[model samples]
Target chain A: MKLLTLNFLTCAIKTCKTNPASFPLHPRDAELEIQEADLNLTFLKNILPRLMWEELRVISSELGLPELPATPPAPADLVEPSNTPLDTAEVTLAEGGAEAQEVEETPSQTAKDLHRILLETCIQEGKLVCGSCGHEYAVKEGVANFLLPGHLV
Target chain B: MLPTPSTSHVCFDRVYEPAEDSYLLLDTLSSPSETSFLQDRFKHANSSPPLVLEVGVGSGVVLAFVAANTQSIFGRQDTLTLGTDINSFACRAASQTVRDAIKERENGRSVFLDVVNGDLGSAIRPHSIDVFIFNPPYVPAELPDLSRHEYYNTIAEGKKATSFQQDSYLLQLSYAGGEDGMVVTNRMLEQVPEILSDERGVAYVLLCAQNKPEVVKARIRDWGSGWNAETVGSSGNKAGWEKLVIVRIWKSAD
Candidate 1:
């Protein structure tokens, strides 16, 4: 399962719903894999507001991945400065910033790094243990199992 | 018309094959009226990308369709899609179905999170989902006995394949809703209010004639003031047992 998915999941047990610690399920004995794909800057920028930076940092730490920035990246932070190497609009009318031309901003390393951490990194096998009740959810072959025992349910 | 996501690679013995109910969801979600509603609801570009969650994503036809065509359906390319199924086999098959669908679209593709194995929306965080979809087990049959779920959910230790009985049990989890078919849907409906995003959340649920569509909608309306439920799309085929309709549920300012 992608670390991005952990943002929206919680302990499956009924009582844990109200517990503050039920969220950000901690990863244990995780096996990580990187599957690269084309990164879209717009998506990374737009998804920033929804992410919980502290929790994600905690997860990143638990998975033994590189540390994430303490604060989420701003939309502008994902883009390179004005002198973009891969500018789609190369032939810009640069008449001393006549009307301040709108060129598509190139994605920066920050965007690539965020994409790598959230989308590309996957847990091939692991266990997600809830903080509140200490319930463990198993992850196998990249799919996590949140199904609880009948008694627990 | 949007092309239905292919589930040809899924093993029908263990996963529910896309059927009329699934097609109805496709038709409704892509229809002009529904698309406009979704697009308008999620038009704000700076707002965090809308999260789409689908419970019981058997074969993942509906979730894949939404993920592949998020530009047309939600009017945004950054929509996030997730899925969950009670049966583990369906969960794995659905993850691939959605991934392949997203990969097929060169542009305007949405992100797909993993499809986990869980009951309804039990594993979802509170107030997280922006768009919810469910092609529930609306068949009016005795619900499958889940006593063997643990044993049937996985292949035997050191064995490469699951037994035939396990496959049958897994398939039964896809359908066979008990007692007027509301047994499962009711459980899911109870979680809708708690799981949906406060301001922009919406849900599209498929129900058959036996499920008493009117009563279900009425109950949803009674969720509170401003809580609304309406049939946005219907097959209009009353003769068959699978006469289906898609109910769009949401809340609006008075």
Candidate 2:
């Protein structure tokens, strides 16, 4: 399972459905695998608006990734293509010796980090414990077992 | 576009391969009318990126098609596309199929496709799914064949059993649709009210003649007071005259 999927999942127990602590299941002893995938700026920008920014930040921090901004950028800023010449600016900055244009490139660079954190990282094996119920759902061979017992079902 | 079974990983021999039923479901969803209907529904709802789920996403082709198409039009990168199957092999095959499908697409839209190994939509949340798609096991079989208990017992004993025993058990789980072929489909129909979004949520389910589409429609209507079911499309194969029916279910305001 990928960390992205974990964001939407909560404790599946019926009684925990409305429980405030049921969600954002805490991952314990998670084994991570980073596989390189093509970075599509369009895709990353599109998904940014729908992400639960705070929950994502918590997960990213839990996984030891760099901190995401406390608040996501305005939705409008993300979907609309930036006219800042991101590519050209990066090239010019590299030639001018990195430090000079560092501030100008942060937005695009941050987008890349978010993309890597959400899509490229996969949880190969681990257990997700419900914050409310303390029920542990095990992830084996990359598939999380969320099935409850017959009584729970 | 649905990927051919050949495009799936080699281990998918035990997985339910994409067949005529799968293609019919894809064609129904791909129809221009259906596409526009879904687009209009989402546009009107102004809901957050809609959640589209496929129950029993054998090879993941159907869900991939919907995801790719919706992403192209809805232009929402956060649109969640999920698939669930009881079989672990099918789950893995589904992941591979979705990856291959996205890689083959011309557009660079990235869809969040997640596959969980579970029965029907048991793992999913209630009243959260915006679009539901299911292609269930609808082939008629005897009582013994429909017994999940027996199936698991065989699997437990599979270590000492022959390869044939294991293969048969997998086949039974994939194809055996006890009684009128409505066993599994009925179980899923009962879950529609629980999983479907309260407003304007729609489900496309593939049914066959043996499953008695009329009975299934009545059952769905009874499942929800204002819910309605309509036959979206149907096709018949010449060889065995095996007919496939696609039914759309949704709640009516009035």
Candidate 3:
């Protein structure tokens, strides 16, 4: 699962739904896989406002990745026209141009870091422990199993 | 705001690619009537964005289409899209599909897409979902065909299996509804009230003739006094035409 997905997930145990700690299920022994995807600035900027920034900061720290800013960057700053050219090499490469030189121009640091956490990082194996119930949901082959036992369901 | 038809190429063989039933559900969601109904609700809703979820999001095409249309067509931004699928490959494919769908939108709306690998909607917080969509495995099949071992074995052997054999494996998980094609859908229906937002929760479910849409609607209405069910859209011929219908359910104010 992508790290972005963990933001919305909470413990499924019926009794745990209302508990404050059920949310942002803590990842434990996570095995990370980084698969590079073409960064879509529009998507990154669009999704930033919806993210729980503080929750993500805590999770990112737990995963031992570079820390995200305590607060999300202003949406306008992340999507400024200047950042658009950072992906020119990708656009040209997609057009089948062999001479396209990789542009060293950097995107906003916030965009780069958010891209890494949201799109590139995949959790291949681990367990998501409920902060309240202490239930460990297994992650196998990048899929987090969220099914509860019949009684729990 | 229609979903790009290229999703089939992005979906892996094991992933449940968009099919006729999926399109029918999309049609129901994007139709002018449904869009207006949702828009009216958005206008009056409180500060929080409505949480929209799709259970069993195979290729994630349905949720992607809704997210894009909810903004581009309806001019509404207060909606967050979430999806879940039992297939691990599906979760990945869904995430990719959602990303591609909204990549070009210039709207400053906060469009959030998150996918989970879960059974039904098990990972979702109860009473948090404002709109729920489920297109379950709705084809009747023997119990053994639904086994996880059988599903993996079929995928391991590749896609060269005969049509009948293919139907018994991972593909079976997509279509094998079991016991009148309502087994999985029924399990989901039971959890609806618990998972749905108490104020104005709405659900769109896909059903075909064999599954008996009328029976399902009756069951949903019976779930509680406030629940109501109605057919929002239907496609194909009445006789043996694989007729699919989208059923909308919601709780009426007391």
Candidate 4:
């Protein structure tokens, strides 16, 4: 499973739905893998508004990944520096253009790093523990088992 | 007509084979009306791509179809797809189907999240899903005993794969809805309103004639003042039975 999946997943227990703490299932002993994929520049530029950055930061630190910025990057931070050689291609549109208006703008290192963490990283094996109940959902061969036991359900 | 995702590598003995109900979901989702509806719904300037979740992905033909045609259907290349299945075999097999189908597309790549092994949409966070879909067990047959799910979900001791009997049990989970075939569908319907995003969340559910599509739509309309359920696609009118139809449920912006 892509690490990004944790952003939208919560504890499966019915009772946990009402609890905000039930979200962002915490990973334990997670075996990580990186699978290369095509990066959508548009997605990279527009990802922050959809992301729970605080939760994502917690997840990254838990997984022992490089710590992220304390705050989410603005869309303007996702573009190449105007001084770079790539800027030659986008030089005409650099003047007074709002964020991401020019199709010619190249993605910055920050965008690539964000793309890698969210899209390329995978959790092959782990246990996702619910914060509210501490119930463990096993991740086996990249597929998490969210099936609760009869009594729990 | 869009190319159907191939399930050739899937073992039908354990997984649910693509059938009429599955095809109806594919056709309805990719139809001109649906495409236009979805595009218009998420067409805001630089809006984040919508998340598409399909419960009980079965052979993954439907999810894979949506992933491969995100540009055509969702009008966004970055639409994300996630799936869940109670049958472990289906979860594994369907993941491959989705990945392979996406790889086959030369361009316009979409993201595919992993397929979790879970019951229905229980694992999803509240108000997290933008577009949800289901082609549930609507056969009006007795549901298989789920106590054996863990055993059937995994290979027997010392075996290379699941036994023939276990395979059959897994396949049974794909259909067999128990008592008018609405047992599973009913449970899922109850979750629809809770799981969907309040802003633009929409859902597509496939129902057979026996599932009482009319009553289901009426009940959905009663979900609240803004809720609406409409049949957007159907096929096979033999014996006056709508063999299969797709009901699109959404909260209208009133």
> By lDDT, who's the top model here?
4
DockQ of each: 0.76, 0.28, 0.23, 0.72
TM-score of chain B of each: 0.97, 0.85, 0.87, 0.97
Interface RMSD of each: 1.0, 3.6, 5.1, 1.0
Task: Give the alpha carbon lDDT tens digit for every residue of B131-238 in model 1.
Answer: 999998888888887655788898999998888989888877788889998898999999999999999999999999999999999999998999999999999997
Off by over 4 Å in 1: A83-90, A94-103
lDDT of 2 by residue, B91-144 (tens): 777887777766676764456557876767765666778889988888998533
TM-score-wise, the better of 2 and 3 is 2
Writing each residue's lDDT as its tens digit, candidate 4 over B164-225 gives: 89988888889999998999999999999989999999999999899999999999999889
Q: For candidate 4, lDDT tens digit of each residue in A31-61? A: 9999998877777776679899999999999
Query: Candidate order by DockQ, highest to lowest?
Result: 1, 4, 2, 3
Model 3 local distance difference test score? 0.75
Q: Which is better, 2 or 4, measured by lDDT? A: 4
What ranking emerges by TM-score with the best candidate at the front?
1, 4, 2, 3
Per-residue lDDT tens digits of candidate 2, residues A52-132?
A: 788878877887878888888653344335545676577677788555653332336566566677777888898888888
Best by DockQ: 1
TM-score of each: 0.95, 0.80, 0.72, 0.94
True contacts kept of 4: 0.79
Model 2 TM-score on a 0 to 1 scale: 0.80
lDDT of the structure predicted as candidate 4: 0.90
> Cα deviation of B81 in candidate 2 (Å)?
1.9
For model 1, report DockQ.
0.76
